[model samples]
Target: MASNISYKCPTCGAEIFWSAEKGCFDCIYCGDTFTLEQMKEAGAVVDQPIDEQKVEHAEEIVDGEYTQTTDGTVSKDLVKYSCSHCGAEIITDRSTAATICVYCGNAVIMSEQIIADFAPDYVIPFKVQKNKVMEAFKEFSKKPLTPKDFDCDKVVDKMQGVYIPFWLYSGKCDGRIEGEGINKKTYRRGDYEITEKRIHDIMRDGTVNFEMVPVDGSAKTEDAAMDSIEPYDFKDLVKFTPAYLSGFLAERFDEDADKCFPRAQERIENTTRSELEDSAAYDELDIKSYQKKTTIEKTEYAMLPTWLLYTTYKEEKFFFAMNGQTGKFIGNLPISKVKLVLYSLLGGIGGTVVGALLGMILG
Candidate 1:
């Protein structure tokens, strides 16, 4: 991973940007001070995944389903950190540990609780590094209606590398669901009566082999914005490596895999149901009942990538997100009120003048 990514502060909730000039992290909150080296010493640990020791791995997993390895070689776990100064949390893949709080700007080492809660399955290296992210931010601020003093430069300092947690679920699907449907028809006779029929049918009995259904794992992420930056480049996913996480910041799932899995299952079921319904077509959809129950086996966890930013105008915050792998931009944008009013008023006055002139000419 490239060096110099963003991080969050623990004491206060401000997003802290990394500054090359400062060299050391400058916390805007609580005025705590620490360097990357100091934070690293406090917050770094790595444990390799050991498949042979299932019991040990199980013990390590504090909250969710333990990700077991059959290889006998245990996957290593790292000591992730949340900024004591700013309260921002992160997981690092590589050994170099110290980090500045992106929010409060204090130095922080990894915490044991953060390590356990945010353990992730894999990571996507920063292909579009922190600098690139800063560049993107600058471009974004240049758009119309952005604050007059909105110095993209200042945002750069606030830009920290964030590894938002996501759960990627994949497994064989055998779905079954039950729902009632009604079909009504009328006969155009003197004794005509509306005939209504209740229909039921089995939705699926066959297996559906699915891959990479993703669910958000971080409460910090906005649901709508996260969803908009979808369709990651799964092909670019590399084998799990902490080196990929070096110089950047990341989060392990606060939401456990088991809890998060339900969301994935829901998405898969919905997609599968739609597919089945499509096969039944509207004209041929003579149904009495619909039952679909999906059994998901052998689910695997992967981390999909996202680049996100939050901006505020007139106290109203706006979020923007990009698919880190695919570079698909998705988010809500606000129109400039001043510009809108200017145009509206100009059009109104111009129309009134023209109407009066035409009336006089016609008379």
Candidate 2:
């Protein structure tokens, strides 16, 4: 009941895949070269909703027209696909967009993965190469006080590139804030000091338009860790195409965009408050009443590139993540107890010598 969706070279039967090195789909067997556009022209790549009716087709059927037989060859909710190499069953959940076969280690691109509503609008591909992970890791571990026992070599070698799902949101904020402020001035008259204080009620109302505030849509990813690596360059964001996911792994968004709005609003308000205070010339401001009205303008589902490494030391698991495009790494390394003790001893000796010199001087 499964489908084999491996892309192969036209001339030779060997599997041709997207190569990050070549930046295109290339065949290793017969030395055939093809681009994603070329494959789309050759009917090798397809997008759901059948956008290209201009090219010409014999028949067109609505999405609901496709029926799944009892054999489970095709269905909307759950699907079973077979590996072309081993004929083993490859199961995929409804939201799982793409994955590789565990049995044969071959790529399995589900045919009906992206339907009308579940499709992504943009994709940020991996700009970081496989060989660059270690360089980034070593740079991250080069701190002066880093533990001597922490090993960077073993962890960096096994780094994995995963396309994390994120929901990009835009909103408009109309905020009205009212608060009491205090102004104080001090003056010296002769031998006495006189202070004058003025208490005033202040009110401000403004609108803050936020564009492309992101929240991680996958529950598997830590929200703080993702936020630590800030600002994915949207200039490089591309229209989503399954061809771009050829060599990488991606997962469909499990959490809806609407669910991410609360966090977005909180962040927007915090930023708006800072901006308002910076613009104001008040001596002291305390916001007692706040009214923030927000409307979500846009929501987009996309796959963003990330490199994650997991390590365990002393029976404790550690996590490290790097923004694949920018190669910005964030992680905490363990401290060495031996180094800590030695530093403490040296500090104690220095303190004792300084104390003895002070005693002799006082005597």
Error of 2 at 338 (Å): 2.7
Question: Where is model 1 more than 4 Å wrong at Cα?
Answer: 1-118, 147-149, 175-205, 281-288, 344-363
Measure candidate 2: CA RMSD.
Answer: 10.7
Model 2 pairs in collision: none
lDDT of 1 by residue, 1-363 (tens): 112223434445443333323444445655654454444454422223322322111112223222111111123543334444444443333222234444654434233213333445565544454566667766755644444665567544555445566777777555453444345565665777766565645343355678877777755566666666676666656555333343444555556678777777777777776666655423335434445565655544455555556656566665556665656665443445574456456674365644443232210
**Candidate 1 local lDDT, residue 188:** 65
Top candidate (lDDT):
2
Q: Work out how many backbone clashes candidate 1 has.
A: 56
| Best candidate according to TM-score | 2
